[model samples]
Every structure is written in C-alpha cells, then in structure tokens.
Target: MSESFTINRKEQLLEVAARLFKQRGYAATSMRDLAAELGIEAASLYHHIKSKEEILETICFELASKFSNAIAEVNDIYFNAEEKLRMAIKSHVQIITENTNQSAVFLQEWRNLSEPKLNAFMKLRDAYENGIRVILKDGMNEDVFADVDEKFASLTILSTVNWINEWYNPNGKMNAEEIAQKLCDFILGGLRKKLVTDINYKP
Candidate 1:
C-alpha cells in the first residue's frame, strides 16, 4: 500500500479499537478480535504495531495531548473570564466531537493503564481538568460566575461535557458545531443568571 493508504489503515485500526475498547473495555478487546475487525490476520496486525497496549496508548495519548493543546490555546486568548470559559467549553467539546474515538478511550480507559504510564497520563489529565477549573475559579473571582460553588460547578461542567461521547452521535439531529453552541448556551445561561447583582442603579 502507498504511504497515505498505510496511514489511513493505521488510523482505521485506532478508530476501531477506540469503539471496541469503549464498548468492551481495554482488557476484553483481544488482539485477535482487533485483527479480525480490520480484515487482517492476527500476526499481520503486528506488522503495523507492537501490541494492543500500543494501540490503547496511541489513542489515549493523542487525546490527552489534544485536550492539553485545546486548553492551552483557550488560555492564551486575550479575553475575560467569561469569554475564556465560553471558548474553553466550545473548544473542549469540539475536540471531543471531532475525535470521538480517541475521546471515548480517554474518558473510559485511563483507569486501566498500568504502572508508570497510568501515573503519567493521570498527571496530564489532571492538568487538563484543572485548566478548566482554573477558568471557572477565575470567573468566580471576577464575579462573572456568580455564587456557585467552584469545585462542584467545575466537576458538573466537566462531567457533563465528558459524557457527551456516550450519547452524542454526530449523525444524530444536531451537527457538532450546533451541539457545542447549545451546550455553551445552557451552561453560560445558568452561570449568568446566578451572577451577583450590584446596586449600580436603584430600581
């Protein structure tokens, strides 16, 4: 196969593995099953990679990196906390929607990692989560996020956003961009309504 075709095949493998892992969990997804899904012999699958863990790592690591990059990009923007939060929500959701497979693995299989690798991935994952929490805290400090409990609010937001991979079908009613915008509206609206009002005008 041509180089492009080879790359495509490998990507196909990753995508399949992501779904299988999501549905069956990592340990249950045998190498033989993966090979059969890809229309190749079990041994032939080795030609492309080392082992099943390699595929899991590839999927999870790329997603961890993607999440980190998205948060960093949002943080670098010259905007206020509200704008940053909006952008963070939009960017994070968009990345997951675009890379649903990797997103699934990242959300579901991180716990299954072994040894030093699990610790490393969890560090990156914590940074990503904390990046969002920082945005929320900044919003709270600026009085843009109202009187909400920061930790609870942050986890609620992240959990809701993270689980989008479970029920969200891009082929469903709304397009990815539309789904993201709707989520932004729902989250921001609630936050906005809870904003602390001051007596700038006596009404």
Candidate 2:
C-alpha cells in the first residue's frame, strides 16, 4: 500500500476503535471486535494497529493534549478572568464536539490505560484542571467572581463539560458554538453573582 493509503487506513481504524471504545468499555472490546466492525480480518486490523490498548492510548493522550493546549492558548491571551474562562470553555467544547468519539473514549477510558501511561495521563489531567482553577482564582482576586471553593468550582466546571460526551449530539439542534456560549454564560453567572448586600446597594 502507498504511504498515504496506509496512514488513512490507520486513522480510519483508530476512528472505528474509538467508537467501539466509547460504546463498550475498553475492557470489553477486543481486536476481533474492532476488525469485525471495520469489515476487515483480524490480521489486517493488526497490520494497521499494534493492539487495542495502543489505540486507546492514542485516543486518550491525543485528547488530553488537545485539552491541555486549548486552555494553555486561552491563558496566553490578554483577556480578563471572565473572558479567559469563557475562551477556555469554548476551546474545550469545540474539541469535545468535533471529536465526539475520541472525546468519549478519552473521558471514560483513561482508567483502562496501563502503568506509567496512566500516571502521565493523570498528571496531564491535573495540570488542565489547575489551568482552569487559576482563572477562577484570578476572577476572585479581581472581584469579578465570588469567593467560592476553588476546587469545588473547578471540579464542577470540569464535570459539567465532561458530561457533554454523554448527551451531546453533533446533529442536535445546538451547535458547538451555541453550547459553548450557553455553558460559559451559565458558569459565569454563578461565578459572577453578586452578594445580596451588593445587589441592594445603590452605589
């Protein structure tokens, strides 16, 4: 096979594998099952992929990188805490929606990863969560956000965005941008809510 065809075939295999990984837990999926889904013999599938775990590693780490880079990009910009948070959320939802299968696998299957890889994946996840928490901290410092529990807020936001994989449909009426905006608005509304005293004050 030509180099280009080989690459495309491998990518197609990964895509199919991601779908299966998302549908069935990684532990329940097998190379034979992946081959059957792709309408290829087990041997042919092996030629394209080394192992099922290898496919899971690729999908999980690729998405971990996307999420890391997305928030990192938002942090590099000059926006205020609120805008920075908004942009970060938008970037996140875009990654999730654009690669729903891979995102689902990434969200749900990382625990199936072995050894040092799982360690590495957890570190990446912590860094990404910290990146978001810093924005929340900055907002509190700037008085743009209420003083909430930083870890609580961070986990809540992460849980909310991550749950999109369970219910989000690209063909659903709401597009990625719409979903991102709504999420941002909802999150920011909570973060930026005023105290009753502040609301009652006539300054």
Candidate 3:
C-alpha cells in the first residue's frame, strides 16, 4: 500500500499560506514570503508540500467544495422559489462570514490555477450559478418576483451577494443572521414593482 502522512508541518503551511494568499493574492505571494510568515526557511516547507500551487489548490478546492455542498443542501429543502433564494443568500453569507480567510482565498485566488484545474473549478462554479438561476426562474414563474429580465436579474442578485465578502465583518456590529435578513429584504424589494393601479387609487 502507499504511504500516508499524518498531520504535521504541511497542515501548518496550508493554514499560514491561506492568510498570505488572501492578503497578497496568488500572483504576488511568494514561497519565501509564506515561509517567513510561518517562521521557517523556504526550503523546509518542501518536506511537506511539493510547491505553492498545491497550497492554492488546497484552499480553492476546500472552499469550492464547502460552497457546493451548501448549495446542494439548500436545494434539498422543499421551500418555495422565493424562500429558496433567501436560504441561498443566507447560506452563502454565513459560510463566508464564518471562514473569512478561506473564503477570501477561494474568491480571489482562483485565477492562479492551471488550465486543467481551472476548467474543473469553472464547472463547479457554473453549477452554483445555474442553481441560483433556476431559483430566479421559479420565482418569476410564481409571480412573486416582478416581471424582469431573468438573466440580468440573476446576475445582479449574485453580484450583490458576492460583494459581501469585501466588507462583511463577523466581529462587526451586525451578526450574520441580521445581515442576511436585511439583504434578503433589500433584494426582494428591488425585484418587486408596485401595483400601478394602486398608485392613484386610495381606499
């Protein structure tokens, strides 16, 4: 049988590398920089990991899998389309909020992957977009969402959710639940239009 390694320096390297990657990004971060952060020589890291690309792969794959699993779990729920959309927002926000470093590495460092690996990641990424798009289509069908361009509306909604990573702070005044609720309400409000007939009619 092949040999398997136990938890050791490599795990530590992965952890520290994630932070550096988030701060400096994949293109700018160097192996020497990662080694210095971990208080070890650059060559020592090689004993555990083959190269820096492995670190990027580990972070990206882990985050992608977490996000993929969360989306799948939400799909299993029997809620209506609008409710599903809310749950998707809450799930995405909560995951990123809780694991800020990993989430950051996953979001910004994806471009560092090799072509084959990037293709694989894109497939998973598209799965998420497709899942959200289906929910948007369902909401449109249910008449809960106003008559809007499904594709454009879906893109806008996804962009809004993705931007939260830039400013959302778990240690800040607002908790994840509160932020999710506020965002859900805000997006839903925009997606809906006032009944024109009621504009001029007063009870």
Candidate 4:
C-alpha cells in the first residue's frame, strides 16, 4: 500500500479505538473488539499500532499536547487576563468540537494509561492547569479579577467548558466560538471583582 493510505488507515484505527474506549472504557476495550469494529484481523492491528495501551497513550497525549500548545499560544499574545481566558476557552471549545469522540476518550479514559506515561500525562495536565492559574493570578494582581483561589477558579473554568463535549451541537443556536463567548461571559461575571459601592450596598 501507498504511504498516504497507510497513514489514513492508521488514523482510522485511532478513531475506532477512541470510540470503543469512550463507549466501553479503556480497560474494557480489547484489541479484538477494535479489530471487529474495523472488520480486520486482530493481528493486523499490530501493523498499525503496538498495543491497546499505545492507542490510549496516543489519544490522551495528542489532546493534551493540543491543550498545552493552545495555552502557550494564548500567553504569547499581548492580551490581558480576561482576554487570554476568553481565547483559551474558545480554543478549547474548538478543539473539542473538532474531535468530540477523541476528546471524550482523552477526558475520561486517560487514567487507564500505565505508570511512566501516567506520570508524564499527569505532569502535562498539571502544567496546562497551571497556565490557567497564571492567567487568573495575573487578573487578580491587576485588579481585573477577584481574590479567589486560583486553583478553584481554574478548575471551575475547565469543568464548565469540558462539559461541552456532552451536548455540543454545531447546528444548534450557537457555534463553538459563540458558546465559548457565552461561557466566558458567565465565568468572568463571577471572577470579576465586586465594588463596595455596587448595587445593594450594605453601607
């Protein structure tokens, strides 16, 4: 077979693996199950990938890398904390919408990875969260955001957006960017500092 065909087949294998891993959980999915889904011999899968764990590692790391790079790109610009957070959310939404199945696997099946990869993946996950925390801290320092705990706020933001994979509809009333902007509006509403002279003042 041609090199392009080989690449395409391999991508197809990953896609099928992602679907099975998402539906059945990584540990419950076997090479035979994936091969059956693809209507290929179980042994033929070895030609494309090494093992089920390798497939899990591939899916998890690929999405993690995308997230890390998205954060890096957002930070590279001159935007303030709020703008950076908005950009980050939009980027995440776009990534999820583009790869919903893979995103599901990445989010839920990541823990199935083995030791060394697990530690490495956890480090990357922490680094990505820390990037968000840095933005939150910048906002707090600049008086753009409240003095809430950065970890709590970051987790809140990530959890809020990560749920989009469950009900995201491209043909719905809103696109990914619009959905992301609405989420930003909602999140920033809570994150923004409150003024003492604001409405319903106790004084």
Superposing every Cα of model 1 onto the true structure, what RMSD results? 3.6
Q: What lDDT score goes with residue 201 in model 3?
A: 35
True-vs-predicted CA distance for residue 119, candidate 4, Å: 0.4
- TM-score, one value per model: 0.87, 0.89, 0.86, 0.88
The most accurate candidate by TM-score is: 2
lDDT of 4: 0.88
Cα miss at 147, model 2 (Å)? 0.4
Cα-lDDT of candidate 1: 0.82
Candidate scoring better on TM-score of 1 and 2: 2
Q: Candidate 3, residues 1-203: lDDT per residue as tens digits?
A: 25657546677788788888878888898889998998888898888888778889888898888888888888898468878999999998888888787888887888889979889988988888888888888887887777788778888887887788889877799888888898887888655667756422345
lDDT of 4 by residue, 72-132 (tens): 9999984787788889899999999888889998888888888999999999989999999
Candidate 2 Cα errors over 4 Å, as ranges: 1-7, 191-203
Give a tens-digit lDDT track for model 2, residues 49-87: 677778889999999999988898899984699889888
Clashes of each: 0, 0, 0, 0
In the predicted model 3, the residue pairs found to clash are: none
Candidate 1 vs candidate 3: the TM-score winner is 1
